[model samples]
Target: MDALQSSLLHQSALSYAYPLYRNLLDNSIVFLYHGPITPDLVVDILSLVENRLDDTGEDRRISKKLFNIMVESFSLGEDVERGHAVLLVRQLPYLYTVAIGRRIASSAVYQVKAFLDWVNTLSPEALREAYQRQLEKDDPRNLSLVGGVPAISILDLARKSHGILNYNFEYLNDSDTFFSLEARLQKTI
Candidate 1:
């Protein structure tokens, strides 16, 4: 239902809950639910629902409502079925782009810092490798960018979207150090 609803979900209090939804989407800590939901099945269902969506500007309020409602109702279901509830919660990342689509990530050092800050909360090694791998397969010179990295690149994918990222902004200035961002990320996120 989370994925299906995110086929577009946005609007007011529902949006207020998107941060909580995103936190649940974080991969570091898991709920450890007991049930029949295999991770593969959750991924498959989420991809199916997400694939059916178009790239227009509209967002999914219905999905947000269902997600919010599920947070309450799913816990009430039998323990054996709780895994499916957990699976649904896992889909919130799929809806993140929709929730934050309009926010400006304009050319700001803090924007990259902000992005890296968010990445710091998750597994940094995983996030770094994911983008590096994507960049290896494409030519990034033609893409719309924020700090030279594609603003909405496929690297930002939440395991639900299917798009090829064709950019690589790994070229850091001479003054930039490997530990620079990582140091700040560790401190904040």
Candidate 2:
């Protein structure tokens, strides 16, 4: 009877996990990481992603854009040490999507949402101009500014992705919210 119960538990776990496994496969996920973001981990992830992009023979420009977006996205989180984040890279039919999800202080949710919304409305040229303006006004070297508010890195990501930045904020509690940002790069001919 105990053996049968153990088998049933294993089957149930498999049943729950199969769909998630299938979803990853269906999404053409090239890279997926869910953990504390560290400097060394970022380097390793970038190296793996670079190799994967090369192996797939992705267009040079698109790969570079994706790489830039990943770097910017990873750095957007001002308090990465305080939360574990998820980073996913997937290939779609027309473009490659790089997504980073992290938890942020609820106080900054409005600023992040506003910034992303404004960015989404900009044309490529306007986005580039915004990037330049922010670069001039803000110190890009200091990523942790304004108490976890994403500064120039967000603008750089918007420009690198050609304004194809998508973001969402989910309220987790009174003090923290889940922030998801996605940047898409068009596959060039």
Candidate 3:
């Protein structure tokens, strides 16, 4: 990767203990076309990370690094790619039948859980993830993760985690058919 790319990852990695930080990264990735990154390049990097239509056939370190580059680059400059990034992710089907759709939900679940565990062990004073209002929006290279797990699972995990964390997912069930994994736990616990 390039020097600019490496720097973003280095800064964000300091808060790797928090899902909010990763969420920040995911948020930007969800919309790579939001800053210096382009739609075609965003998809190219995302395809590497997501194993979507990429031909790398290997690890996605480049994509991951590019994510950091996208965020940090924009953070240091003005935002010119956010609109395109937002549009692309907004158009993706989180619950569709495509390869990304099937894995996104499960992968989202894993990313959320991993982030939670990581933060649980950290001293709250040492970090800050998205607590309220919105998720990640500070950095540019972070790249939002529009195609994580299904919205159902993401919302379920968020709501279930609310009491334990500062973020909440009350609006998750905004969809009539949506439900959290906590719904069952709420009854049992």
Candidate 4:
């Protein structure tokens, strides 16, 4: 490869990367991770987010809530065996958005969507009640073995985020569907 060819290749790579960089910047994305989600990675991500929040002088209360939401969101990726997952945190004018995406078995798509729809319909009080019931029913010791994590975590997420959970499913193929879940936390001044 000559110098000109090398330069062209570098420019080609930059051509693809610059747009993605701008998109992330324009969208106010503060953090992004796309790959397998593991416990260590979750801790590192949370630490980075915590540092960023502290640096920005974010409220302690809101920081705690955001941490909890991130934990639950990242846990969703633990079960993905066939595809990678995506986690992104975006800072907007009035709210913080935490979004997680993972590919799930096509057969589970309908059930997951229906469950999210039902959870989204509940009032805050009802969500609290549901969370309490799930907490009581779930055995902490067995949570990991059951299914990577339990639905109780989702309930907890809904309760903390004030029931503001958003989700979508993108059809990937006959065997898999990409599911994305997002929760928004309002910034209090």
Candidate 5:
């Protein structure tokens, strides 16, 4: 066999592969997407995640809830690329964690931070109230481009899962910020 072929079967190569394999078995990975964000791309990613969840025998109700949360959070961009983004879905023994990362304009960082801060402070009942309020109002200014209430679904999902939404914004030079949010869905869901 050629060196390239032989190397593929070598202990050294297998050693490097084993950790990732073991991790997959221990903590299921639901989905991962890292690219320029787009509407079609979001739909495609969700479809793939749905199929994988089915294979793993995840509950349909929980799957749907998770899917809704993902769609609301990830599908908010315009047709044009809004810079590169990353979405990672991991299933652990105690929780399912979704982490999304994207680049945002430096100016909007405070707005996002304030919004997240308000969300983080809300209790489950308070979140439900806020979500209801958003749904009741149908003003053009309040409507999200993707339909449904903006940020309401995220708050509802977090409340339902009894989960936490943690967000961070790191300054990337003068004009951009690297924004990331990690949401944890409890195993009970």
Candidate 6:
């Protein structure tokens, strides 16, 4: 009876939680949460990340910018999922990045690719101007649930911060694919 109990406990502990806990410790993860997206969850996460950024003694302006970008990213992901999504954030010395992945309807792939490509073609100044133009629109929410204003804002931020905006798509069987989008913010030294 003792051996069986010990085996069960050991297996359970080694399965999921242990590796995740180890990674969290090893990676200096300031914020990590993935599950259902609720208003409360978003609020709590913003507060936690805000405090963590404060502790790092970073510039107040940069910290605020990063926080707002994060909130918009979370909001975008939640909108995509309608309830659930995955948000992964990693903090490094000079680079802070967040990748939000969600299952998206495959029909939207071309549109997403086109949008990214168009943004890629713009110079920093041009991007900023385009973003302002987007902001001038009344309502830009499409069927995909990605708001134009926030998307343009994020792209503008990525450009101004000398960071990168990237994406990857993996087909999940048929009629759907997992879309992972990442935005990075590089600290200027």
lDDT of 2 by residue, 120-183 (tens): 8888788888777777777556543433756577777777876568888899998888888888
Candidate 2 lDDT at 97 equals: 87
Deviating ranges (above 4 Å) for candidate 4: 1-12, 139-149
lDDT of 4 by residue, 1-189 (tens): 999998787666757798899999999998899998889988998999999999999999989988988998887777656668999999998888898887877777777877788889999889989778877777778652212235776777787788568988899898888888898888882
TM-score for each predicted model, relative to the true structure:
0.20, 0.83, 0.21, 0.86, 0.72, 0.77
Q: Is candidate 2 or candidate 4 better by TM-score?
A: 4
Q: What lDDT does each candidate get?
A: 0.35, 0.79, 0.32, 0.81, 0.69, 0.70
lDDT of 3 by residue, 1-189 (tens): 999998876786646667755764654433323234444654565455355424434235533333333332222122242121121221122210101111113324445556544444544332233322124342344534432322222322333322232221223232211112211111112
Candidate 1 lDDT over residue span 1-189, tens digit each: 698577655545676587765765574322223244444644554454444332332246534332333232222222231122222222233332211111121334455555544544545456667666756755566544444334334234322122211111232344331111100001111
Q: Name the candidate, 2 or 5, with the larger lDDT value.
A: 2
lDDT for each residue of candidate 6 in 53-171, tens digit (9 for 90 to 100): 78879888778777766776776576533345788777788877777776677777777767777787778788877777767762655422242224654565456445457888888
Instruction: Choose the strongest candidate by TM-score.
Output: 4
- The local distance difference test score of model 3 is 0.32
Candidate 2 vs candidate 6, TM-score winner: 2
Q: List the residue pairs that clash in candidate 4.
A: none
Q: Candidate 6: lDDT over CA atoms?
A: 0.70
Better of 3 and 6 by TM-score: 6
Q: Candidate 4, overall lDDT? A: 0.81
Cα deviation of 142, candidate 5, in Å: 6.0
RMSD of each: 18.9, 4.8, 18.8, 4.7, 7.2, 5.4
